[model samples]
Target chain A: MITSPKVETKNLNLYYTENQVLHDVNITIAEKKVTALIGPSGCGKSTLLRCFNRLNELIVGTRIEGEILLDGKNIYQNGMDVVDIRRRVGLIFQKPNPFPKSIYDNIAFGLKIGGMKNKSRISEIAEKSLIDTGLWEEVKDRLHTSALDLSGGQQQRLCIARALAIEPEVILMDEPTSALDPAATFKIEELVTQLKNSYTIIIVTHNMQQAGRVSDFTGFLYLGKLIEFGNTNILFTRPKEKLTENYISGRFG
Target chain B: MNIRNITDKFFHYFFLVSGVSAIGILFAIFVMLAMNGLQTFTDVSISQFFLSTRWNPSAFGEPSYGILSLVVSSIMVTLGAMVIAVPLGIGTAAYLSEIAPPFLRETLKPVVEILAGIPSVVVGFFGIVFLGPLIADVFNLTSGLNALNGSILLAIMALPTIVSVSEDAIRSVPKDFKEASYALGVNRWLTLVKITLPAASSGIVAAVMLGIGRAIGETMTVLMATGNALQMPGSFFDSVRTMTANIAIELGEVPFGTTHYFGLFAVGLVLFFMSLAVNLTAEHFTKKYRRYRT
Candidate 1:
């Protein structure tokens, strides 16, 4: 017996006002795997990631045509709560966006929204999630401190911990490490590899080497089209498309 | 010296002179008021002026000239106006900056601001002619002009100041903060209450302070609608007088060398001090918020 894909997109098309941003696309994301979407700037990688959680709904005049399935259920169907969908499929933004609140409160926000009223249980879960992201030891003594005071790398990890506290099945990261230094980026890459054991992960990144290091599967997008996709090792070693070859080889963006 | 050095020194002196000149004018006005009014403190006991109620400076033998009742009346009217102005003004501001659609916002913002540009004398006339009669009819009172009517008119006059300032404060909050809250799956109302309002609280408080200062100093509206009565007001329906109103009313009657004249000056001095304190407090809080936000 085979399990269904964790997430699948069927003939997805997107437009911003009159300008089309994403062409007809079809892809399937497996469970408990790390998939990276690599492309140049303005190539619709981030746009495609945003489609999974409906972040693009905030923009006026943006239209999407097609269907997205998560766990064999259509996400855009009537009576499906966007908030509930977002809670199940969490997103970590590129910039670290910790609330101007206490570090503890930042992690507990989603749990509170999900109606977890027991204080002790919330504290336990917050601690567990923070430790899972390797930030508990550094911030345990000062969990009440303002999140803005944390270092850039710590803030990014805290955001990941925040997303984890919601107990999402699939985590979507939009270039989560592009804003960080090399050391911080390496740490985040390691965390992503470790997280793939239990959670299906999708990431949009511009770094070819980082993608090769962390991702098991990679999809190359250019001009809103998926040019090529395959195992990370195979794609880097032998890309079928010339555009993918040129992009991975640094000939042009 | 070099040309660049000379130009820089010239510019620095120009800025210094401009700033000093502004403060210097304020100091001059305060010193003048004090010099003209301080004699009242010496001639009559300051305690007598503050504690007594009788305000008949031209009475038969006693020559009573107490202003305590007027001061009390002024506080009462200003407080009443603030009770009506602060909430309505701030609510209008929130509606304009946060909730109103773009087309409605553009229309309502200017309409609210136009309330400020109307001359105070026109507001005074409208209060006496229209609002005073309507208030008197509603309450079935003997006189139309009263403290309640005055407060209502002043409240309308203060609305524009509060709305404009508070709207600016709300608009100044960073967009990223709102986006972060939305991404957390928080609803619009909760995000506004928990994030946007708290972040802009210092500015809102400053707006309230500025509104209070304007209400306290307003003269023509209070003078016309309040019946210029120098007795302590017992209720919202009773006629009363305020510090600015009393000064404006009595300035023509009091002789330049007399105690009554100096007492009016003293009232002006008190108004100046009150507004100065309020402005300074608002400035302090605004600076504190800036430090944290930056």
Candidate 2:
């Protein structure tokens, strides 16, 4: 497997004020493949995912050192446009956070923000994205209705559609199914499987079984350090690190 | 009964009495206003009382009880006050909640609260001595006491309420909404204007409504700053009298039980309804805002 990485982090370190969270993490994420980050609570898995899109900069006192390169361009460089970085790498949160807008507007929002002004083009992109997320049929007749009216699963799918509508190269999911039920989680897992062929995905999930089911590569983090990084099947079964073994076996956090 | 049951009964009766007394006071005021003001309808027709622009309570032969001018003046002053206050208040709130550094926000919030605590009479005095004279000079008016003067003072008085409530609303917008907007690559200004403000709109609307209620019910400031002239204002600078000003000025000198006194009471009743409408609107919007939280 000699595929070049789509995203690479070189000695990435992140801090919130004086408290360091992620320390000297280095990994290369292959293109059009799902890479899952698994760790215990407060282990900085979500923080790492947010760093990909520079979402962590929103919090005051946050500091990041080292490089996060997207397509070989260092995103952390002074001249790098953060908005372009975010547009290139879309993110969805753990909880479904659809705007309190019409269902149609939810998908249209990203397009509009990305400067897609033509109404017909926006509608076409919105419809295609919704269909890709498999929500168009159920909501086609009621596109004008409030997005809040949708069920939690539908809303999560809608959020995915919103992220996809921007046509990003990579998609980051921060425990996107944790708040959902098992059925909805399965639906999302299946959707992730289908989405990976077209977009590079980096998912942060606590559910180990889900990481195995949906991801190609799995990275196990412990106390802000990358403990193990390998194929999902190999890491789950034959982890090289003791901490990874204990964490995966549920022996200890 | 046991001692616990007896104590419970006593407390329940006490609570009931307190609640009834509060309601009773409101009932008593309504009854007083109705009993005194209803008779004005006999001397002056309902249409004339509501529609006529002329208000000459001490006319030589016949007194006119028309409050049209007063109502118009009240509306003009309130509208003017809102026009001045809304932008300033909301802008201050946005800056405090979203943009201002913590040190600046902490220093300014208490200053706004203290502004709310200033006595209306003191504000009225400032309006008469300073604001009125300044306005008169700037606009080339004969007198500074006018709707504009009253509006400026009322706007200052209303600022604290609007800023505090709107700031709270802006702060309470879930961090997730902001994150989502930011993840979409939208800038802070667009995020505040589009997502944050729209999400917090119900609360902000309630804040503005409450501010309007305060401006409409304010008496001393308007009475002292506005010329208290019985005229429908043609412009913000024109001398005029608000409903509260009319009631305050007449209630002091008009003999009790006279038609003049009753007319003032009628104006009070109308003002009460206007405040009630404002409060109900505020309440409605507040409830609607809460529905968005969950």
Candidate 3:
């Protein structure tokens, strides 16, 4: 038996004014699985990740030509609310962009925006999300402190918890652990592995070892094209495309 | 020493002379005002100057210079202008720095700043020609010039400073703060209120103080539009006189050594102290904000 794709992108083209960024791309992300998009810098991996939730719409002069379907509904359809889409398909950025607010408020921000008004309920959800992200033990005592005071790794985890507090079905992470130390990177990878059991996860990363360890499926992107994608074991060990072989073998970035 | 050493000594002397000259000018002005006005403080009760309403310096064939009415009128007009300018200026700044597109912002920002370059007399003329009559007709008054007219003119004059300084401060906020708010799906207005404005609070306060300083020190606009009545402002439409206006109007008429002459000096001293206090407060907040950003 086979399952339907949770998110499907068909002929997705994005341009920054006269400069084309992502060219004629097509991909599908399986539901409730960890899928990683791997590429070098400026390979359009982050841009493609932003399409799932329409985060690119915030930039001026950014135009997109494509169909991105979330659970079979076109997200770009007329009258579709971008806020609602973002709430359901949350995104964590490359850098740890925590709000200059309390640690608890950082997680509660999304919930309050989504119309979750009950204070007790917000606290409950924030605590649960922090625990799920494995940051509860370290920050449980200072929940009222500013989020910016946290270490880089802890801030990234706090961002993850913020996204999780919204109860998003799919979480998009763009180089989530790249800014962290080795030990924090290991901890995030463990958290990602555990999170995949409940939520569909798509991550963009340049670290091949990280992708290999955390992702069950891998898609190789090179120069704005999805060159090849398959099970992580086969794609890393025996890639069919010469470009993928060259990229993974470390001949060139 | 060589010729070069001699030239360097001359240059150091030039710097020292200019720096000391600037301070000396300020101290000279203070001492002059104090010496000229010392008799008023000794002979006249200070409370009388602060409490009495009549400003007829020539009344009863004697100098009857009471500035309580003029001071109160100045405060009223300045307060009214601040109430109008601060919100509009800060809102326009927030719009320019955070919301307006690059094209619109580029065009509107300079247009807003151009208000600062226009001469204050020209602004007063405009108020006298336009706003004064409009207000006079609405209130069925005999004269067009009044506190309302002066306040409207001063508010327009103060707007450019408030908006430009505030826009700079809001622009100085880190881009990451905005990104964090947007990522949470909070709307633009809420983010400005909750995050951006709070982070830039000290800067905004400084901008307001600068605007107040500009409004209080304004002379020509108040002289022309406020009717120079030297009476307490009973309402927005009532004619009034400010301390700056009083000094400008009376300085040439009073004899050089009479009580009336020293009364003008006293008013100047009051104006000087008010501006100094405002500037010092702004400086303190600016330093506090700089430490926070660092």
Candidate 4:
């Protein structure tokens, strides 16, 4: 099936102070589909992911010189509402970073911040978000307990639920399972595949098999450049770039 | 054991005694206070000692020794100081941790520490000369020295503790939490107020409790500034005395082996327990709310 590009970067170059971190690069991410970015450490995968929501601005002296468009609108244009951009495009961190609040509050925080005041509607969305992330039954009874009490996998899922509760059109995950064990990683990988039917998912991962298993479209980045991009199955099996082949075969990261 | 082990053993025993001696000194203080203070209850009925509002020990007639007024003065002054300090201190802390640029935060931090390090007597002097005159001039009171003066001085004294500790608490909240809030599309101000502040609430509460402890135990400033009136305090403008101020003022001139002398010790005993209770409550909050701090 063909999918329209939800987000696309045009000759994106990012600099941290004097050091150029992301070279002139361009890539298209599909809507309502799981797009995985795989590369070794320091390859600018996470940096590119952060560009989608302008989270890179949090770091001082970081500069972006190119346009990152969401639904064909330049997000980096002057006077663009960053908070609104981030609301439309949410993100999940590598380690599960839930608030110290209870499970219910963790999910309700975004809705309340977005000015949703109807109590019953907030609860309904909170319950639905939990169900979407597959954590409802396990956490339903303990909704008021601290989110920190959940296990690592459960905490990561709660982060996803929290993002979903805000109803963002795009969801970005930065190595969302890097801190989890194998079983937990499997659950998250499965959840990522299942979540693509509704939200445009962009996942940055270092694991080759995870990228192959979960993503419908795969982009291999190397040395701050996109080395290859294609269907995940075709990219895994067929050779288009020597660097992609070399990195994929476990010769070196 | 080798020579190294022998040296380690020696240091271990030495440190053990060193640590134990701190508690020993505390026990000695409690024992001394109890020895001197228990004698007062024999003549000063518990009701008369703690209940009555009058506190005249040297009356030509039957001396009335009620500490209720002093207690109220201390609490009211300290609470008023807290009213002034908590918002300002926490605001400064939040600015340092979340908003202020690096140079501003660095410059302000040492200023707060210096504020704390200034001698309480020096603060008392300022209270009497500057703050007292300002309060009287602004409010049109007869005398500047009052609970308001005491509170202003105590608030200055308490600001350093509150700002220092709450700043630490706010700073220690993981950057990840702030980032997470930003990811949810909340503005920076809302994130700091709703998420960052609440996440650091445990440490902030502990900081506020410790400020209360500091304000309650402070003696010199209140003694020199609060006019040391003996009657029940009616308003913030009314001259009054705290238990610490009372003990400090009378303990020096009281004749030896007198009930009045022992009465001062009783006041000291009560002040010590109040400070102890405030500190313990601070510690309790720190421990109880630290579970989610990870």
Judging by TM-score against the true structure, name the best candidate: 2
B44-125, model 2: which lDDT tens digit per residue? 7889999999999999998788899999999999989999999999999999999999999999988997899999999999
List, for all models, the DockQ compared with the true complex: 0.43, 0.80, 0.48, 0.88
Model 4 chain B weakest 10-residue run by lDDT: B285-294
Pairs of residues at least 3 apart in sequence or in different chains that clash in candidate 4? none
Query: Per-residue lDDT of B166-218 in model 3, one digit per residue for the tens?
Result: 89888888877776666666777888988798888888899999999999999
lDDT of 1 by residue, A1-253 (tens): 1154799888889999999999987778888988999999999999999888877887778999988999878887888888888877888889888877899998887788778999999999999999999999999999999998999999999999988998989899999998999999988999999999989999999999988998988999999998888888999999999999999999988
Task: List, residue by residue over B68-181, the lDDT tens digit for candidate 4.
Answer: 999999999999999999999999999998898889999999899889999999999999899999999999998999999999889989999999999988998889999999
Candidates in descending lDDT order: 4, 2, 3, 1
Q: What does candidate 1's lDDT look like per residue over B107-167, in tens digits?
A: 9999999889899889989988899889889999988899898889889988898899889
Name the regions of candidate 4 deviating beyond 4 angstroms. Answer: A1-3, B1-13, B288-294
User: Candidate order by DockQ, highest to lowest?
Assistant: 4, 2, 3, 1
Query: Taking the tens digit of each residue's C-alpha lDDT, what string does model 2 give over A1-253?
Result: 5196999999999999999999999988999999999999999999999999999998999999999989999998998988888888999999898987899988888788778899999999989999999999999999999998999999999999999999999999999999999999989999999999899999999999999999999999988998889889899989898899999999976
Give candidate 3 regions above 4 Å deviation: A1-4, B1-16, B34-39, B54-57, B61-66, B288-294
Candidate 2 chain B worst ten-residue window by lDDT: B35-44
